[model samples]
Target: MGAKMLAEAMGMKALLYANWERLELAEVPEPQPKTGEVLIRVGHVGICGSELECVVQRHPRRKPPLIMGHEFAGTVVALGEGVANLSVGQKVAVNPFVVCHTCRWCRLGKSNICERRQLMSMHRPGAFAEFVAVPAENCHPLPDHADTRLGAMVEPVANAVHAVRLTGQVLPKRVVVFGAGPIGLVCAQVAKAMGAGFVVVVEIAPERLAVARQFADAVINPAETDFLTEVQALTDGEGFDLALDAVGRSQTRRMAVDAVHPTGVAVWVGLHDDETSLSGMGIVYGEKRVQGSYAYTDDDFAMALQLVVGGRVEVASWVQEFPLDEGVEVFWQLARGEARHIVKALLRP
Candidate 1:
């Protein structure tokens, strides 16, 4: 305890987003848990695809000179005043969205879209350091059998959980997911977990498609063949019961709109493109439903944790772990698409 306390008094190593395309590895003062917050000793922090936008100064909410990690898991080191549920040394995964409970959206049970939502990396310092402070209510206890590496995946899995839940009353029997990236793969898996009968993944990258084939019933490479023809052949021209756009490209969005059956649903989970054109009459005449899913609700987060802790979801196959000091180079590699073989990267502090 004395040594741990001494280490806390001394500065800890942290990777700081100093500027666009710039990250600095420096020793910074240790963070203390404020009221209703818990100080966690970070075990692992996964890099998000959206963080690339933050690094390039494109994300609207995230600014520079920040600690940019949100998908993370750790052990509770200290509990702040007024926090009683968590204890020291309890392993937990974090839900990074800190919302204002007073907002109308929050009051309506849609806190994921809270008007005053403050994400950990975007609004406050995050877990790219040895320690991070988060609201005690955001922590979910992981089972003893669960690895912290897999625990770090709970957040992204929760994203998929929320996206699939947005389909509204229709549980997809035949589903097509556009893109085989991290989110896309997880979306397919969660759809299967949620009882989708058939799931197909579409991707241009052979490596990613091969990985997606592990979880999906089928995989299609759109670069070599016609995706629409293949999808039509699979469903006998009925179109998919559900279509999800996990790659936020104009082409993928269009594919989603075209692939879903009449009166079916299309969910847009990716945010790559801000503006896309869809046929107005096509939507009206076909009675197709399109919805956008952002982050996850508290119940979704809890269910995600349960999935990981219960060994129902597996992420160890596609994740690559690196030291926290190597985050800058890893971030650049991910941004440049150099690490195409791996699905996601984790920074271990």
Candidate 2:
């Protein structure tokens, strides 16, 4: 059925990106599922850091008059034609990246980099609303006993899994994570779950650092201490086997490369900044490998869900929840950095 046909039947509240640097709780016609799609009734949706950056900076790709949410958990309220695998009332965590299966990257099992990829918030209406339509294949079913909020966390955890998996390290002895944001914290936990001997987290925010201490073997505040010296001391001057930078600044990027031992790997996952200058000779002489990680593949997503469901990673304690009606205030508070205590925020619709 067409959306226009359903316009009079349903009206739902959504946090709309009505304009640049503005969010409004507006009632709009709920979306209708198309062929091969499923209409979900949103349960919990996370406010991604990237969404805050896009809204505050007015990113070109994420144009306004859009509903911007991707990390979400919901129930299958209705199924479109040709979608027979899912049924009404089934709980699920969604993979928001819609890719063209015929692309070369997709064929190589790297659909995260597909040439023609469409993201939920950027390319179409997202789960910030009461209802969203997504491809049936994008939904990963959750266990009957699982908390719906945990389903909302699967996306960010998948990001950490993808970043750590990209390093190709088997049971790294020591790992260092820059930034104690949601991604970095999860990376530390994932490294430990994958058998890293020790994990260190570096963050300037004291609130975030305090939370980091819960998961990391050691937490460092660069503003109050010598970061490189402390890192070297922790590794007995040998440096870490792997370093992951969840902060995309030039300094953190360089530090990630420097914090790893010779021939070690450095993975960059954050997107705070675009351009950075590094010492070419240093990377060459050290033989250090640097890789960039984007979103997760299907396998990574499934693995992440397993890790979360199996209780290998922590989620509930660090996440804060608010009503969907308060999304505007919550978004602005997060954008202004007022809610340091909240590692993650979810809007309950």
Top-lDDT candidate index: 2
Candidate 2 accuracy as lDDT: 0.92
- Return the TM-score for candidate 2, rounded to 2 decimals: 0.97
Candidate 1 per-residue lDDT over residues 1-349, each given as its tens digit: 6976975687888988887678888888899889999999999999999997667755657778888899999999999999999999899999999999889999998999999898999999988999998999999998887767988999999999899888865677999999988889888988888889999999988889888989999888888988889988989889998988899988899889888988988899999888999997889999998888899998899988887677566688888999998988888888887888668999999
lDDT (Cα, 0-100) at 62 in candidate 1: 75
Which segments of candidate 1 are over 4 A away from where they belong?
Answer: 1-9, 57-60
Task: Write one digit per residue (lDDT tens) for candidate 2, span 55-172.
Answer: 9899999998999999999999989999999999999999999999999999999999999999999998898989999999999999998877999999999999999888775757
**Candidate 1: clashing pairs of residues:** none
Give the whole-model CA lDDT for all candidates, comma-separated.
Answer: 0.88, 0.92
User: How do all models score by TM-score?
Assistant: 0.96, 0.97
Worst 10 residues of 1 by lDDT: 53-62
Q: After superposition, how far is residue 162 of candidate 2 from its true place, in Å?
A: 0.6
> Which candidate ranks first by TM-score, i.e. highest?
2
